[model samples]
Target chain A: MKIGIMSFAHLHAEAYIQNLRAIPDVELLGIADDDAARGEHFAQAFNARYFDSYAALLSAKPDAVLVCCENSKHRALVEMAADARVNVLCEKPLATTLTDARAIIEACERARVKLMTAFPMRFSTPLVEVKARLDANEFGRVYAFNATNQGEAPLQQRAWFVNKDLAGGGAVMDHTVHLADVLRWYLQSEVVEVYAQTNRILYAKEIQDTRVETGGLLMLTFANGVFATIDCSWSKPPYYPTWGGLTFEMIGERGVVLVDAFKQNLTLYRHDLKRAAWNSWASDANQAMVEDFVAAIRDDRPPRVTGYDGLRALEITLAAYESAERGEPVRL
Target chain B: MRVGIVGAGSMGVVHAASWQQTPATLAGFFAESSHDATRLAEKYNARVYKNYAALLNDVDVVDICAPTHLHHDFVLQAAAARKHIICEKPLARTMAQGRAMLDACRNANVKLLVAHVVRFFPQYALAKQNVANGSIGTPAVVRLARESARPKRPPNNWFFDFEKSGGMLLDLMIHDFDYARWLAGEVETVFAQSIATENPDAPLDFGLAILKHKNGALSHITGAWAFPPPNFRTAIEIAGDAGLIEWKSADTAPLEFFLHERAGDFPDVGLPSSPLREDPYTTQLQEFYDALLNDTPTRVTAEDGLAALQIALAAIESARLGKPISLAEARA
Candidate 1:
């Protein structure tokens, strides 16, 4: 697949470059971004041709385009990709507003092309396995859920990401969508209401230092009896213990399922550290996701991460943002 | 198989219930004191014994759910009786005690398995798998915790007594310390700060320890017994150059793993809660049974338990003296 790069404004844009390189079937045709310096940097780093503008990049007639630009630009980017009759793998928070998200979806519909969100975590192995297990009724009646997506400060690193107009909301908007989408996808349910709080504790720059709430907690009541408590905060130090953490816990009638994005070993100690080693064999899911995406595109099938899925996740993120801003539970 | 349960306290009951829930049969039980023993025995329709030696002689397998202070003597008694053993955590109060138990079990040719239930937790196991498979590059840092709401019942109230439970370090934080050692490798040194029980009348219930591993992996362990209510949690985080993995205990949610999707993309990964019916206790017990049946070494051996205990003891020493304690000094 000849993949052309959209604006390299979002941090996720770099990932598209890497993923495109990782997949043998995908070829990087050209790249463009409003930030001339960033576009040049990306083009030079990925060894791709630099297009002066989105129009020039579209003119190159790539098979697909990855929209790794800011949320505010997602709709326009998708529309451009659709006008050029190219598939899109848009970065999350598909749009700054629901209206923009809907418009992007409609444009993709009108274009008759695939519009998959770049929610790569869904393609992770542990999550896929967990989803299967939940479907198998391993935990029984999934009664409640709690999730956290946390990290250190992102204000100085990616200032634009904290802007409510550009990035939507802080952590609630930037981080919650991925988790919110998983809740919907795994439970086959939608969030009905959300009570959330957001804060800018760390950053004192032009953009909110912490877009997501630091120590911000949210209570999400799903369509089913699945009550979810979510914390989407960038509250740790830059060199936080976990690179970036997403924790999901599900409670059921029969048992409980707890998923940690990062867990290496589970051991016990009495008086020393030797002889107490509990090791299990499980495969990693990153390569699987990339491979699956390659296969899906090769077979002309819908991607594992659909645009509609992105829409749902985006809705929840917006809801959380609204709830935090209004100081009330925002109903979906 | 007909099983004998040692210890008749809260965990003893939990174990007995878990065994009953499984295909295993509970034939008898033994408690240090006859009262708790009789209570558990009557509830489970099993025999109760006051004498550890007599209890060892009656059962094919000895499930050592006794207090940490009693693990050494009970395990030695069980080993001499030629009973396969499954011992609860903090295998012994001291490394010497743990080593003696291991030596005795080895001489008797009886399989001795120290219960490291965290390994049995599916989420933790998955996290371990991720680390082994290089999910997060080489494990660099581990931040873990064993937190609870409040201690409804403690280890004979002696848990606060350092000679018995080794305070929060051994009774609780030892789990994560062992995990850090396992995933990140040897602990070269540890610096810890502890919250002494405010009410001198009360026991020490909270502690925090920072471990510096031989391989430069930094681990942080925090534990508290006075949380809220009915909240039992264990969380482990391992970060590597490539990605990160975290195992978080959940009352509700499935076990999940998160990986790096993009270099700097904020929405790196997401995980759906994976549910499971099997718990750490059952898995540990099964491991014990398998080791006994197959003439295999236990997954968590006595030596490993001792090492973890040493770390806990070191933490306590560090806290007490308000100085960083090297493993060498700890060993001494």
Candidate 2:
């Protein structure tokens, strides 16, 4: 049950540290980031041991590692973890390219360890409820999904989110993978086609150095004949209540279901803040996700969301990018 | 001025109610045989005409709320009678029909207001105005989803026939299609997917469409006939650099009552309504009436309706063709 965090590059590590703390059996062994200052800061802030480097942390023989590195850096970190015979819970997009995603999966397979994508939304309470109903055929045959995974540009907390090289792409690359994995899981089908359009509407001028799309609309067709659109955008303003939210309306033959996963919140207007803010009281999907990651290693079984799932999602993001460039639908 | 509604179905009853709130008088309603239409006519202290021609003869303005396939004929007959027209959306089932309806109205020198009611919705109008006025800077991405309960209809009902009703895209989603264009000038391309069910009981349909606007904006629109009645939902999120505007029917409603013994079998009762004082349909009809009185122009002109229809048709074509369709190719 010993686990180490690979990098604090992605902000989700801030929450993951607390999530791992809540688990009874899982020990958050230590922190490891290439940036010594960052490694020392979080290790002290969270009251954990600090390692000089990711390699040093891996050599310490932690059972598993959580890779919260930048989008493109996931492959390197994951490959590094696999080389050390460690299981991995990698952050989303899996990798910038389909080849890297496939290679990561193969490397993990060869090393005899599981690689799980950090798609926490798969464990989201409300979304999980919907999936159960869908699996039970209570929603009849789901026909379409209208979903959005939107947020304010992660410029302040993680500048790498907007960096084209580090993040792979912008909003589409950053957000699309979460729902893509969920859709494949719910529909039990792989995406057959991807048609997408991206825009530099929100942060083009603000982040002039990096040329990346801040907004994207994607249309996807599943093998089961289900169709969906994902609005993955960093469109929330800085003054908004929180980062943003994930919302969807699922259409089915029996009935329609609407999910606003992050809607459980109280609007707080504090004197210290300039604007109103939403204080969400949502059940922690991240906590459940990490728990599953730990359970998989303990049971010596595959994680609920696997490396192939990550590969499938990565394929979607890459196809979306290709389709947007060619101004057409890219067939699988 | 007097207003008579044609094909007294759901939209007919709604338009009849809206007309009663205006300065104009309610002339009557014409349907093949609609019990609800008779009830609505009685409630408004109006007649239920046995024939379409008779209703057109009496009313100053003809409000066509018939099936999609019948709009062209209804509009043509109304225009021949030299009556001003208020037509429910999709404009027409086909581009040719929409263009013909526009030409007929123009040649007759009668005012034609394609009743795109969402434009008159205060929230939607305000959101569009905010985007135009730079409240959100340059509008990058517009996202919208409209969900309506699939009301039970007779097996022979025209609404059950996709050919007659033009399916969910034309019947339900054309509203969002119009709104998307209103928010982002004109659409240059459309890609879409649809699920058409064969279940005799529900016969539900769901559609998703993506529009790339000429203004460098992208819009995602979803239309569904799946939810339970009174559980109808609408959501919009327009994101730009300066800010974001988001709203949902369930969230913004002034009242919410989750009755324990409610919401199955019997559907369309007291729906969750927001704090808006006047009904949006009333506002739309009144504006059209005033335009006819002043000999000015309606807010949603026939050309605008045609344009929205063109985009909707393009989406339908995209879904049918399994390809990304340019607006020009769709029009051709």
Q: Report every candidate's CA lDDT.
A: 0.70, 0.85
Docking class of predicted structure 1: incorrect
lDDT per residue as tens, model 2, B179-266: 9888888899988888777787666777888889998898888777766565678888787777778898867877787776643655
* Residue B45 accuracy (lDDT) in model 2: 88
Interface RMSD of 2: 1.2
- Name the runs in model 2 displaced over 4 angstroms: A23-28, B2-5, B25-60, B257-277
Model 1: CA > 4 A from native: A204-215, A264-294, B1-332
The C-alpha RMSD of each candidate to the native structure, in angstroms, is 17.5, 3.1
B49-135 per-residue lDDT for model 1 (tens digits): 767666766778888777789888888887878888888888888778888888898899877777767666776777777888876
Question: Chain A TM-score per candidate?
Answer: 0.88, 0.97
